[model samples]
Target: MRSSDFCIAGGGIIGLTLALELHRRGAEVTVVERDIPLKQASQAAAGMLAVRDPDNPPELLPLSELSIDLYPAFLDRIERLSGQRVPFQTTVTYQSVGHSSLRPAINLPTGLIPGDDGLSRLEEHSLDPRQLAPALLTAVRNTSVVILDHTTIESAPPAGCLISTLGPWGAPPAAPRKGQMLAVSVPASFGLDYVVRTEHIYIVPRLQGPRAGQAVIGATVEDAGFSTHTEPASLARLRGLAAAFLPAVADETDFPIVDHWAGLRPYTPDNLPMLGEIEAADPGSTKRFVATGHYRNGILLAPATAHVMAELLTGEVPSVDLCRFAPGRFGKA
Candidate 1:
């Protein structure tokens, strides 16, 4: 039997980031993943690192702030150690009610304002998940870390500790929320350089050059667990919403379809992610830790989550207070 000081399930962004952190701390780590690192939702994600958006729940603000602060240094460290640039850019994210509605200016603690165009400027940024996930996997591969791809984690083996970083949709069937999305190639003239979010639709610009101009459209949340089917009615509603927000996109193509996909986002009832230790079901075990249920913020929160997990594993003092996010917050301790 193979053995390591730590074993992480789910090779998505969160899992890989945790592995990297543990390895850096001098603990032998092994990652067991079900899919090739970027082929799932991690690759399909638009990679918008928006934290200051007005729509975000207040309880999540601390985690969001921590992630935003950690991103630059996180990217720098990854590049220096892995020798690959993870493309990241800080830009103004916009949220508008309607083209004609008077955009209400929201006062933010960060001092950003709602611009004249009736859109709030969120101190947010984006990264190419397609590029970032693969780069992380490659970096892990180059190190002493072990990666097992194309294998599902049927059960957890007894260990000194176990961390579950599985996202919301990754939980058991009863707790899953399926998210549907699509990617399309647009003309350079579309000129959508910023992330736009409305009540019904969101448009995220791809890091690929302007010529190949790409964006992800249609993110309908449904109760269907892990279903990847693209419903025509939902697609039409999304396109209509997009057209209402950006007339230019509506004028360009009636049917701007490209690639459609879906994935389950592990969602808790309250919409906050579940983190921290799970006392073993058996009284004799040492400790079990979980860092899962991060629905859309998986990419944005990866670094902070990894750091917290490492601190918990090593018995070091944690820099941030994790009491609120404890896995036990979900139910009976």
Candidate 2:
């Protein structure tokens, strides 16, 4: 039998980050994952750190902003400990409007500037999730956190002070929404330095390595449960959307379709994460905390969620208000 003062189920970013925090506070920590750690939603994410996203509801803006503010420190710590380049690049988001439509004068939010492409340019940031996962995994491995890969944890309250970061597979049932995306190579003069988003799609440019000039075109949100299949039709639609935003990308058919992939986002009914303690079936049982249902913001919110959960586990009040994310908020999760 495995034992630890803190056993975290699901070693995605949230689980790993929380485990690191708890271990730093002198707790024995073990993380159990169904597959390789950081290979799930954490790795598949596009890593857009958009706090003041045009679409974010006002109620959740503070948490999102807090998480974005916390990212710099989080990335620095991981880089210091793991010695891996966790790429975080500050960029702009060009929210595109349809051609021929009269451009409405938008009261641009803070950090947003008017753009030339019939779009609003919002100063934002992004990182490569592919790089982040490994850096986090490496950092945790350097610590006292025990990671059990390829191990499925089945028992309820799996261990003492259990924290479930099992996205889409935990209580309250976060449904898996699949998204299809594709990456294409870019020419030297691609003239694209920022992310571009329409209501239906987003094009995020890559910053480093061989794919440096390339950009990722995504995604189609479908209510396909846990299915990671890359649909050609969805990819084509994404490509079409990318073309609508950047006409140059469509003109170059020979750049080569670099990669195509899909990932399942954990979407809750309320679209808020479940945090805090689980109400034990038997009142006398030990406490089990949950931290999941982040949907598309998992990458953006990991630091704050880990910090909050770590604070709660250590018998301290979280700096951030979490009343909206209480585990039992959605009918006894």
Candidate 3:
């Protein structure tokens, strides 16, 4: 019967980040997770800080830029608290322009990211999730915030208010879209310094640790409804997508898939995050709130989400407009 001021429903990156912020504001917090924290989308992400990705909704741009802006300080805090270096990967992404809908970065004029071999170079920020996730987990553990792993919020001492940061369980009460990804080792001579992304695939080279020569390729978005199953056909298709950019990955004998995984992304009907308080479950009980349904942008939006959610929780006006992301949006119109 542990108790706290706020009990977070999920302990993924979003959850932990919010917890850190809330705690900073002097709120005693508790986090309840069904499984390990960061085991979901946070761990499965490609860690691309795709702030200017043209595919993102227009309403998301401000928040995206805000998050990317805060990334440096956020990473610093994580490193300071956890005492671990979350290795950085690259500061640029090479987006394939051929047969792709990608507009110039920041809607710049034509030839912004110069295209070569049908590929365009865009300045993007990316980090190694393998390093970030663990460091985040360690950072949280070092904090006074209570974490109840392998448990649900219901088990925590009843709190009048609850916020859900459960990444894929759909805090906005939406569906979970599954994504599958894989990584393969590349040779040093390959000199894959920056991120290489096609229409639907991205190849990121690791430059640190034992994974130095490995390139991470991802992912497949599926409305599979919480299914954890990874399909060979899906992986093969991703490999083919990667092959279009780096022919060497196509040869399993040469690259050899070192690791493969599947994760769920929270998907809302509007494809926007729901970041406001949930209407009271009962006339005067259960003041619920949701900070989920980030879909493909959870990793990218974490800092912004945490900042805005903290502002909302602390009764301060969120610095960014959240009307487009209200939890009850679907019920409107």
Q: Top lDDT: which candidate number?
A: 3
What digit string (tens of lDDT, one per residue) describes model 3 on residues 187-217? 6665677887765888877888667888888
- What is the per-residue lDDT of model 1 for residues 76-143, given as tens digits with 9 covering 90 to 100? 76777678888764375677644556555454313223333466556568877777876787788888
- Strongest candidate by TM-score: 3
Q: Give the least accurate 10-residue stretch of model 1, judged by summed lDDT.
A: 108-117
Models 1 onward score TM values of: 0.86, 0.90, 0.91
- Greater TM-score among 1 and 3 belongs to 3
Residue 22 Cα positional deviation in candidate 2, in Å, after optimal superposition: 1.6
List the lowest-lDDT window of 10 residues for candidate 3.
108-117
Cα lDDT tens digits, model 2, 226-268, are: 7899977788778876776566666546445889889888888
Q: What is the C-alpha RMSD of each candidate to the true structure, in Å?
A: 4.5, 3.9, 3.8
